[model samples]
Target: MDWLGLLAFGDTGWGDELLYGLGITLGLSLATFPIAILLSFLIHWAKASKHRPVRIAAHAYTTVFKTLPEILTLLILYYQSQAVVNWLTGWIVPGSSLSVSPFLAGLIALSLVISAYGSEVVRAALNAIGKGQTEAAQSLGLSPFNTFRKVILPQLWRHAIPGFGNLWVILLKDTSLVSIIALSDLVHVATLAINTTREPFFFYLVIGAIYIVLVVLSTRLQKTLEQRASKGITRMEVSDA
Candidate 1:
């Protein structure tokens, strides 16, 4: 009869259900970010290493991950997690139901997807560092680690923020795909609401509003971070003349 009635909690309404779904979506995004960053950094380094074979292997890693579609990964992980678990341990873990935890399955899927894309962003960022900077740091007798920490990483962020920021927004929207496996993110919650209340249009509209708000806020926050990262560089421009 009313919107709130439709969304109400405690088996009376669906509002609590939607909210819980949103929480899961947010958690999935956040949990993957750190892992993505770590993986990206390591793979980027391997790609950039002086050893030819190492670079080739890194290239293969990035290429494969980047090319593999996320849904494919999700299906594989969803079906295989139990097998993986069983293979690792001779005896079955008492409660490790791989197919049941859609949340974890979605995490693995989106993480692989975002991490592959993030690695490319990181690789380009590393490449943007001028050779002179590294050479100068070496001349100053700074260790490679210190040089990377102090000089290279800062500049790398400045160059990489544009791509990485865009990816963050893209991945935020992409989280909806997890609904297929039934982790019950915003899309699935809205779908349920519409079907239950016979207000398909209204529920969809509400879901759209939620998505718009989240994406807009995220975009603004990313812009602020990018501005901070590029503060020094933005003030000056290189003249090709």
Candidate 2:
């Protein structure tokens, strides 16, 4: 079958399966992103804390995750988490076994890796916020929380945008790694299609094309966000004339 026909719908083609796989891929990324962002901020704050224990713990978290290979992290978390779940199930309800969903497992694994890097981004952004601003806000009778919400966060976001955008692209591509655990993600589905259709080149190429499109769109979206975030900030320009 031609590439177009192979990707066409209506019972004979693998189009539906691929579409479903795409949905799962997007869902996983979307679910992981917000969790990663929240964790990044928390980690950044912990690392910045005056208490030695908090800083030590936060540093250890980032050091461990950033040092480990993502695939290894995923494998360890997936199997270890399942082992814990199984142990609990055996004790709680004899003869009944429970398992972690691949979706949730993949999310947890990816979030750990992404947020490790994101923490650095957040830390840099927070540092970029001048100490004077905090003092100024406090002088205006604003509480720490209000100062962060109104004054610190806005500037931090602008500085963080570029780093977050880069991480977003990496995270999107990293979703393919979930295919290793038989999650039926885009790459996994493509592999199945290739085996069934006996057209490895075509199916793999299709997967590549889909990923390229996603990267392009993500990059464009990132640029849009940077522009929006940097609104009212001065930008340097070179004169051609």
Which candidate has the top score in lDDT?
2
Pairs clashing within candidate 2: none
Error of 2 at 100 (Å): 0.3
- Per-residue accuracy of model 1 over 1-241 as CA lDDT, tens digit each: 6876776778888889889888977888888767777777887788779999999998887777678777777878877885776565645666544333887777777777777788789878777787899899989999999999998988988888778777777777878888887778988888877787889887888888888998899889888888888766756654322
Question: Per-candidate TM vs. native?
Answer: 0.86, 0.93
Backbone collisions counted per model: 3, 0
Model 1 TM-score (2 dp): 0.86
lDDT of 2: 0.91
Q: Which stretches of candidate 1 lie over 4 Å from their true place?
A: 51-53, 91-100, 234-241
Which residue segments of model 2 deviate by more than 4 Å?
234-241
